[model samples]
Target: MIIPDWLSDLHFAFSHRGDGQMSFKHADKDVVLESRNRFFHDKGLNLDSVVTGELAHGAEVALVTEADAGRGARDRNWIEGIDGLVTDKPGILLMTTHADCAPLVIYDKAHKILGQAHAGWRGLASGLIESLVGRLKSLNGTGPSELHAWIGPTIRACCYEVDRDVADRFPDHCRFLAGESIRLDLTMFVHRELWRLGLNPDYVTDSNVCTSCNPEFSSYRRDGLNTQAMACITGIPE
Candidate 1:
């Protein structure tokens, strides 16, 4: 697991491969719940206080409240059709699952707002980051400059080879060409998007850990259909 030091005051963490799978979709429901509960408990948190996204790989972002907690903790009843979740309430954790896809953790410290977004290739293409920032702005009056963000571990450009169709969606600068293969730097794309939205580049931190290369992370590209997932959590203390 990674606990970033960039923003010390907020409660944030990205689970690693050894942390066990948190997604119940492909694993046993009871086992997934047990692992999730243990993980939260170890961090002095409770599964019941976490609001998870449905991870539809879309651009939708939702503002959750304390009442929405535990919506996806033990069952599949996640916040439907949303890939991003944000909350300003204390003690309410926001979580999103990821494998090769990057997990984004955003915090508006000034407003005490926390958010997590699942940014897969499709989600990025659909402008998930923009949707998330827009939600924070509209609901909490939090601008991009007021936010600090962390791009969690993901399949970086070194291992993110894509087809011509996927490469065409992004700019040339975000693509890396090696021999005949085209690789996309999702981390860079996210950073540029955040900058375009008026967020200060200094406030954005990338873990720089590639899931595909690191044995400690679950990578869909590496493990294929049998891949599990890691959980990303962010919140305020009670």
Candidate 2:
């Protein structure tokens, strides 16, 4: 597992290739559960206390509470239509699965609020980050400047070629042409978006670990539909 140093003092983690397949979508239920159990246990977290999003690649951000714990730990009944989750409730982990999509971790230290998001190309275009920040503000008035964020491993521009349709969704500055290939820099897009949202650039960190380039991560672009996935998990410890 890759624990971000920027948020190393907190209970936050990004699963790695050797952490086993964290997603249940393409794996056996019991096997996936076992993997998750072991992973969470190793991190001093309880799998039964975790809440995950359905990850529809939409803009929906759900405000989670203690009652929502373990909703997706053993089954697929996660918060529906949610690509992002925000909560101030301690001990209930917010997690989202990813193959190559970017995993976002947001924390409001003053209010003790947490936000977790899965930002694929579609999710970013859908304004998922905006919705998540808005939810954080509503929860306890945590504004963009007060939020600290981390963008985890994903398919970086070096490997993320896109068609015109996908390229048009973001600003040209975040996309560039490598010869004839139009590649999009997801990290750059996310960073610029956060800056536009009024978040302090110093408080935001990007892992810069490209999933497609790094063998330690699972990449859909590299492994296709049969690829196993990693997961991003974070929470406030009691």
Candidate 3:
């Protein structure tokens, strides 16, 4: 588990190797998840408390509750078409799957509200960050200043070559010409969005790990169909 240092108030982790394939969607056929079960069991986190969505790669942010816990644990209890989740429930672990896509970990310590989002280029274009912020705002009015977002490791512009069609969706500043090919800086783009929405620029941290270049992390764009996903999760209680 790769833990971010700044998020001191919450129990959060962006899992890499040794954590296993968290999702059954891309689990290995021959390999069982008993070790994976033991992993969470050691942390005293019930897999049943983990909440996930169907993940449509869009901007649908869902409000999770204590009742919504375990919806997507070991079964197909995910909310449909949602790419973001915000919860005020303490024990409920909010999670999102990623393989080169940005795994956004959000926490408003003052209000004790936590959120997780899966933002790829499509999700960014659809304004998933803004939607997540908006949802948290409505959740007892926790504003941007109180929220601290950590943009977890993913493919960066150095290896994320894109075409014009994909590049056009982003701001001109977020795109750069790379010898006839365009590269999109997702971390920069995400920072711009969060800052634009009034989040303190200092609080928005990005882990500049490029999944495409780094062998330690998984990248679907680089590893193709056989790749596994990384899970980023955060909760209020210990």
The 10 consecutive residues of candidate 3 with the worst lDDT sum are: 28-37
Task: Please name the candidate that would achieve the greatest lDDT relative to the true structure.
Answer: 2
For each predicted model, how many residue pairs clash, with residues at least 3 apart or on different chains?
A: 0, 0, 0
Which runs of model 2 end up more than 4 angstroms from their true locations?
1-6
Order by lDDT, highest first: 2, 1, 3
Better of 1 and 3 by TM-score: 1
- Reference-based lDDT, each prediction: 0.86, 0.87, 0.81
Q: Write the per-residue lDDT of candidate 1 for residues 126-238, one digit (tens) a residue.
A: 99999998888775665679788988889999999999999999988899889999999988899999999999998888888899999989998998867778998888876
lDDT per residue for candidate 3 within 112-208, as digits (tens), equals 8888899999999999999999998888565688788888888999999998899988888999988888899988999999999999987877777
Q: Could you tell me which residue pairs clash in candidate 2?
A: none
**Cα RMSD to the true fold for all candidates:** 1.5, 1.6, 2.1
Model 1: residues with Cα > 4 Å off, grouped in runs: 1-6
> How many clashes in candidate 3?
0
Q: Which window of 10 residues has the lowest lDDT sum in candidate 1?
A: 1-10
Query: How big is the positional error of residue 153 in model 3, measured in Å on the Cα after superposition?
Result: 0.7
lDDT of 1 at 33: 85
